[model samples]
Target: MTQQGVSWIDKLIWSWAPESFKEAGESIVKNFWLHWFPAKVSRRSLAFNYSFWLGTISAVLFAILGVTGVLLMFLYVPSVERAYPTMKDLDYVVAYGWLLRGVHRMAAHLMVAFVFFHMVRVFYTAAYKKSPTGGSRPLNWIVGVLLLVVTLALSYSGYLLPWDQLAYWAMVIGSNVAKSVPILGKKIQFLLIGGTEIGQATLIRFYVLHCVFLPLIALTLIVYHMWRIRKDGGLACMDQMVLKSEKERVESVGSKTYSLLGITRGMEVNVLTSARAEEENLIPSAPNLAKRILWVTLFTMFVTMVLAILVRMPLEAPANSAVAPNPAKAPWYFLWLQELIADTTIRLGRFTINGGFVGGVLIPGVLALWLALWPFLDKSSPQAAGVWFPRERLRQNVVFTLIVLGILVLLFIGGICRGPNWDFYWPWQPWPELPMHF
Candidate 1:
């Protein structure tokens, strides 16, 4: 009787197990991972369930940056006057605070990298096709672009805090370059620097932008972007929907248009949507999404901690309005252009050009243009994207390649031809000499 009762208890436990741990009398029956299952989230996400873990990585990184930024905010003073010394103090006296700073920096870099990685993955999978549950690819592209911008802003703003040799010179270059804008250029540059040079005003403004504004915007966008992803998919596969018949296609159109907030031609036309609806469930659910989200978030925190402790980066001198640091260098990221414009020997025959246009102006300009154009350029029936090389590939490749080539050529010319002309020498060098048009 005792043995029979024990068997029944074992059977009961095995039946009750939540897809993880189970007891079969004397032996436990389950995979090694059964013990490590996660508590379910209210809303299941690829973050929680899936293995292709890009989005989860982004969320975890953002959390790290947010936590570290908040802590740093308490310690940071947004004053050119107090900023540099304050950073130095953090290094010397802030009780393991530098770890937070290091993690913040490293995470910012990683977030930028991950954004790029995410984009590549989306493209390769043709995941941008619109679906009922997951279709808003355009929104994803926009948010991704903004994420890159915020990453840049974070890097730019953070540099000013350190106030080091590299930092100071880089600011001078950035400010001067900004002044090269044709019309309101000087004014805009002045507004950013908060006066003529990198002073108390400039530092304070940067600190505010870096700590307050950019993060808020980036955070809001990421959340909104994710909500869009959920509304659109398992992962935006379109091929499953496209192969349906003409009758099915016509019916799907009016319904899809209304759902997308897209315009319709005639109210009289309504055919078939049910057949097309089956296309919604193409990509598999994010494998073990809950665990993925948890581990990714946890692991990023670990990485951030390691970066802070190991990196312990430095700060520069006190910002001085009076001193003009000669040979002012641009940030390493922007150095390619600074280096280009610095080349005075390559003159553009007659009109001495500024190379900053290529590094600072044209390349970034083209990148912006491409981001703006991607949705229209890539539009197609979701099902068609399954092909190895879609029929539309030729047109898109041609346009994309040409635009890319034009940008590179401009950068090359600007770098090679810019000389000691007033434009290159001191880009925003006070333009007092003016001709009131005759």
Candidate 2:
């Protein structure tokens, strides 16, 4: 494959074929990859440096999870009676099933981490702030945040699938937290569990949610998120130039304009070498995209495989509604909230707020709302948009960094430090024995 718009595959298949086939291949290649991603990207914005390609890494992980998850579905039947045994079969009976499940589980975890890293990268780079001429980036930022939420939901829903003590108690704690919401909490719980308690119905409900509904929604949102990245302009960094004037914008777009009536054939569309383009710095996406995606995919696969081999997915005793774990915990991602709820209460003089409502509902809701509205609220300089940790953006950066640190601290506490009765314990402390189910 070369920038002249011919691939080795095209030649292999179409060398003795019709010119129409060749032309078709060229057109598709031109319109698909090269059209959106021009020959030139900011040298700084290249995957070699600016991004570490976190977004691409996250996407690759999602794909890996999707493939492995589908394979797992064939073996797993979501029911109280069948779930745990099926998990054992996946590990011991099915060929390479443990590997598949392991990869899926690890990829899901990697995606969660990568998504957060991507958000941090976007923020420190000021990628979510407004562009010149006030074309805001907040819309895409909001979409990305929602994508993150979808990701968490996906992982949490899947957590219950093994139907073990870990899954069972986690669901109990998570659902009870949902039930603590001021109103509509019970309805939300019902929608999630399909009943008042964890049962065959709950497993089936979570099964569909994890395997079908959430994934579909996640894929749709992810596609939209990527589209918006292209629409808003690729990775914000030093390499991008803001189109300041309407004339510059039009000229920068070149002669290729889309119309409902259709683009006229035989019209000469100029290459994207408008007056604003820095031709010396531009490189074609043909080799770059291919190389980056391949490298990222391989790296992700290697890491996932290594993890899968070393740390098999855990399975505890099957769920029993009659017995509860000593200190039930939510999924690791939500441990921060769990810690907050366990540690504090809120009151406004005459008004008292339930700790669960404060930590699980109100605070998380406000934080999400704040994140969605941030682009509109901050009247920061557009010059700060592409730069990493610009001096002028110190205030916002510090604030976000503190928030992140606080969350990590909460996660550490909730995940490792708390033990029986949710009491504080050292990381090395032994857990109190609890009755096993099934």
Candidate 3:
């Protein structure tokens, strides 16, 4: 292209783009979506290693799930008789339906995983601590915990939509776990399945929870979670920057300070005295933060699409309430809990203690409560807020890491080591085949 043409193109682009930082800031203020983010962010907040961008990936996955889920809703019927057939139609008859379901399913699983990893990132970095200049971030941490629970609920609810033997048996196991609650167990299970059995009511209940109630709750929590991040002064790393700036200001009290009249010397001045150091590390969120988010979003979507095409979602035989699988298992995420229940069950000759109540209800409840309350319990120095595995927090970090590893070990055992009849077996061992049911 000629220089004249290039100049014309640049002019056209600049016409829409902000010509100055002031204009860019004003534009962001005026735009609804852009307004969610702060006008400027610290450079540290945008680095890939700082956050691994897991939170951004999670939001992208949620968006993908929303779009694909809405599309699937049009073709799916909540009725038990039609649910299985409709899934088969999605696989074979509908154009690109298989791809749609694959992407949705994969995104759902990935969202759960990424949300979890994001929480772990926050915990390890002590991001949930209060900022020196901002309000308590532990409140926002609680909101994040709620978001994780809702995410899990959304995934579990959707697991039954296929109405396959796998889905049916898994749900049966899940509802029974709910039934292990002390006094309200039966009531909760009834509310969940809508009756004494897993029939049409059960399907519709899960359908509604998965499609409507849970998604709306998740969306609300997500909005509050992001807004809280901004309200708490960007990311927790910004706290470290602010504290560093304060320390530097104290140390440099002896440095020369220029008066307003001395500006004529063409010397640079820190006019915004209090925020001078913070400003030095800040960059406009408009192009800098926006571009990084765009990159992460695109990368996540592309990978999800590739996986959707390569991996096939399973569709087992239609649900059979009568003939249960030899080892009926819950969803993979719940496998750890299942294993815990099995291990915790105690039988003393005549009396028995329900393992479901102990393992599924008590243990997880205590863990979740502890997780949500830990920020308040934490006694580390403020300097440790944004640093990963700081020496000051070594003991807590070790304990937390051990807990996470224990859950992973249980998950591996339940998913891989448990065979038919829920018997223990090595991964490489061959299992004796059972007679065909049909």
Candidate 4:
């Protein structure tokens, strides 16, 4: 191509693009959206192995859900009478409607999974711990916990939109679980379902929650969650690096002096009260971090689209309150709780314990509370932060891992092994047929 021919194209591109490194750094600070990110980030924080990019993938999945969900909102009807028919239309009538719905559903599930994995990664890395260099991260950890709850709530609220037998019974089981709470159980159930049972009111309430309330909450929490990362001085790994460097510097220089001069001047003064060299591990976030994020977003969306194409979303027969499926089950994510309820429910003579309350409410509540308050209780040294499975944190990691494995075991049993009337059956063994009813 001639220089004259390409000159106009180059001009067009450079109109927005920065021509120099200085300009690129300035653009990151000046742009509103990019400003949320730090001007520079540690190279350690950029490694895929360190954080697994799960948080980035989760955020991208949420964005996919939001976009596809809005498209679905146009075709879906909230009324119980029309909900199933509209779902059928989306599956067969509208152009690419099935794909849209599939993508949305798949993204929703992936977001939940990724968010959960992200939390686990944070726990194992001890990224939630506060350090002298990392600042306080416990508050951000609480925000993440709340975000997880909102994510699950978002999924649960949307589950009823199809109004199929699976959705209806799942909602029934969920509401009943709510009703198992001690004092406010009944009230909570009533408020959730909008009366004694699942009806038009229930559908509308869930629709509003799924479409409006929960998404808003999730979006807000996500924004704050990312912002908190910036405020906390990048990832916890950066703190580890800082601490290591400080230790090396201290050992190299025997006796040192500390002064307040660097504090007032906004310069980092070492133990010798002298200005140190700029951070060696830092790199500009404009192209480096932004490019990595772009790649992750594309990769996540591609995986979700592939899954959407290959898998068909389930659409059972229209909801029938009177004719429930034998051993009607909750959503797959809640299968663990369902299994727990079964295991905990016991009879001693005439008195029986309410397993729903014990397994669904009490146990889960205590677990969530413990997770939220754990940063305070953790007595591990700062050195443990950002180190995967550090020796000092091994016991807590083992306990957490065991709890996670237990939940997975229960989920498998509830979802795969339970047959009609909630009887135990091997996956290879055929379930006995029930008598036909007129």
Candidate 5:
């Protein structure tokens, strides 16, 4: 009776003795040893793979953005009438407002960066070239490209909250450039302008788009994107997977001769096997997973905290529908393009050229085509599995590197050349320089 009572007491103590705390403490101890101990090493497992790792990072970033963005909206009022004023208040009136604004801005930038990096990672591995995600590449790439655009859109829309002369004319010139689109150009201009100029209507339109529509779509696509990652078998190479499936499907080649003849347990296997090799290069889960994820989360949170505290969000002056500000700068991100257009001068008699065609249209078209052609050109079948480097992979790698470098150069040239009013004018005018006190 005494021994049974002791055992029951032991069980009760184990069960109720702060399980969460115990688990957390265990994790901390294990991580510390794994992280810093000289004898530490990684233990590999297949719980989650590279695709999950990437999808997890993206999902985390999105979650941070969604939460932070919503909090920001509480302090933000999207109207020409109140937008600038609200920004000023967010800067000074609210507690930790600057921190939040900073968090919001920086988080936005990082999220965009991560999403792009994720796509590039997916491309290089040929994960998107095979079944599942491969079969769904068209839709996947569409989502990726649109995410990039939406990220830019959010950044641009936020630029106006500063309410400065710079913000006003930047929007004006930006809207003007959009109006340069072929065919539906005027229609877009009208839709944007509401009555043909940047005003109350424009502010409200941008506000809604930035705060609501883009975010909603981004969230939806993000979910679909993660699901695709799981469907694709955790970044296993397309060729590798295909090869494995085929070998399994036709393991014997219908050779009943071996069985019927009973030729001394004939077993000269024909199917290829890279299972051992594929399992070798994988990132381990137990320690590496916990460690990488912890760092990523910590880094992201630290960034948010720092931004929310140090920087102040700017709000621009009132919008003047009638007057145009001078020297309008493109959004810092797009200035590279505007600067390019500014230098597109000096014509050869009759034939003139514009840099916008090269910077805006041609470069983007070339990049889009290059990305689309990647699966076809990267002929190293993932189905081949664990064939890390084929005979002449050097040529393919070089081609890809050059293509990337070419795009970077074009964007760099474009960024350096672009500005307001075709790079000639300023966003701020002399009247503003004269200093009218409110």
Candidate 6:
């Protein structure tokens, strides 16, 4: 009954459970949760703060998505003919199916949101910088960036699985954008959709991608990211560690004696031990990480469930290749690119550029490359590490803030302000009547 409080099933599974099984369970928890945690962390590193808990919340959201997604797989049929009806059945027929569907949908959304915020938090605190006072590494920054990409890819791939009119056109616009790339555009689009156009093959491809490949990559990267966080001194304590190092260095020398090397004639050699001091600025990982994971998991799941109840998962008309919605749009996350296309065009001499390539491939590609190289590119002092929006880092922060604001502005325009034919219109305006695709 301890395994399942509902009773009969629990009794069947656990009442006759061996004592050895119980001992093994307890031992596993002790080894993995208790022993592993304390070995990785120190007392001072566990600060009770919002920023410190973003990663945990993101991880919890991922776990929720994984569980709900697996449950959904049991009910969903990926073929175009059955997909929409199956989705409807999930909502109308299956018991608590809507709850599972809603949770999975909302969890993916929240996970992406949290992961973006997590990156913002890391950037502001300069956590990607290596410590000059010693205990830091920047390699995880690249891992974090790759994880962000995988998270977004997972969302985008999953978006197509519903195979509604909305999902179909969104993928069409997205795939068209992929076709805008220079020489490899069509090849990439074909690879993605499994054909030149979206069809049955595309549906299965997306299902496999969303269900398998992207999740596996994301999980692997996330595990490495967490391990690196611990290896790099357990979350941005560089500020305090730097000060401690200075204090210890001063104490080791006894007094501020002038170096004889500077005076010239002869140099005084002070013998110091070769062993390095093991400084403990970390909080106990067992309590800190475990408690954080527990609370954040509960809170995130609760909010997601509430959202699932209040807002029904959107299901539009069944996909018809003969019809296209007025002003077909990409998913919200990629709406900024759509807006960019609406606003800009590139020209070099007599040749004009594909707006899709410009906005979707070129701009995003440049941004991604810059981000991947930022830790190596940044020339900021190590003292700037672990400091959020410090005066010394004002320039860097302002640049990043402007970039974020620009993307948000574009998202707003594409998502809320575009009308039929992509004309400018206010969000409050009633949507124009749907027109049949020619």
RMSD of each: 12.1, 7.6, 4.8, 5.0, 9.0, 7.9
Tens digits of per-residue lDDT for model 2 on 213-326? 999998998888877766666666632454333345475357556532455443223323333354454444544554566788899899889998999788888877778777
Clashes of 2: 0
* Candidate 6 Cα misplacement greater than 4 A, ranges: 1-30, 40-44, 48-52, 132-136, 251-283, 346-351, 431-434
Model 2 worst lDDT window (10 residues): 266-275
Cα error, residue 433 of model 5, in Å, equals 12
| Candidate 2 wrong stretches, greater than 4 Å | 1-8, 11-39, 133-136, 238-277, 345-353, 428-438
lDDT-best of 2 and 4: 4
Off by over 4 Å in 5: 1-56, 132-139, 237-295, 307-327, 343-354, 369-380, 383-396, 406-438
Q: Which residue pairs collide, candidate 6?
A: 42-282, 42-283, 43-282, 43-283, 45-282, 45-283
Per-residue lDDT of 21-94 in model 5, one digit per residue for the tens?
A: 44433443444333222221122222234443444565676778778778988877776667777767777889
> Per-residue alpha-carbon lDDT of model 6 for 220-323, expressed as tens digits?
99888877776776666545565555655666467535444556332222212111332334333333455655677788889999999998989899887788
- Taken over the whole model, the C-alpha lDDT of each candidate is 0.59, 0.77, 0.88, 0.86, 0.57, 0.77
- Which ranges of candidate 4 are over 4 A from the true structure? 1-20, 255-278, 436-438
- For residues 1-438, write the lDDT of model 1, one tens digit per residue: 244454544433333223432232122222222222222221223422222567667778878878888998888777655667778777788997677677877887777667656655555444555554346666676677777677777777877776766667678878877876667778989998999877778878887888888888888888777767555543443334433444465666645555423344532233323432443332122223334455777887887678767775655556554554443455544544665455532567797665555546665767776775576667666664423335655565456557545645544444443333324423334434443221
Question: Where does model 1 exceed 4 Å of error?
Answer: 1-52, 132-134, 238-287, 317-329, 336-346, 379-381, 384-438
Show where candidate 3 strays beyond 4 Å: 1-19, 254-276, 436-438
| Clashing residue pairs, backbone N/CA/C < 3 A, model 4 | none
Which number leads on lDDT?
3
Model 6, C-alpha of 117: deviation from truth (Å): 0.5
Comparing 2 and 5 on TM-score, the stronger one: 2
Model 1, TM vs. native: 0.66
What is the TM-score of candidate 4?
0.90
Which candidate, 1 or 2, has the higher lDDT?
A: 2
Worst 10 residues of 3 by lDDT: 7-16
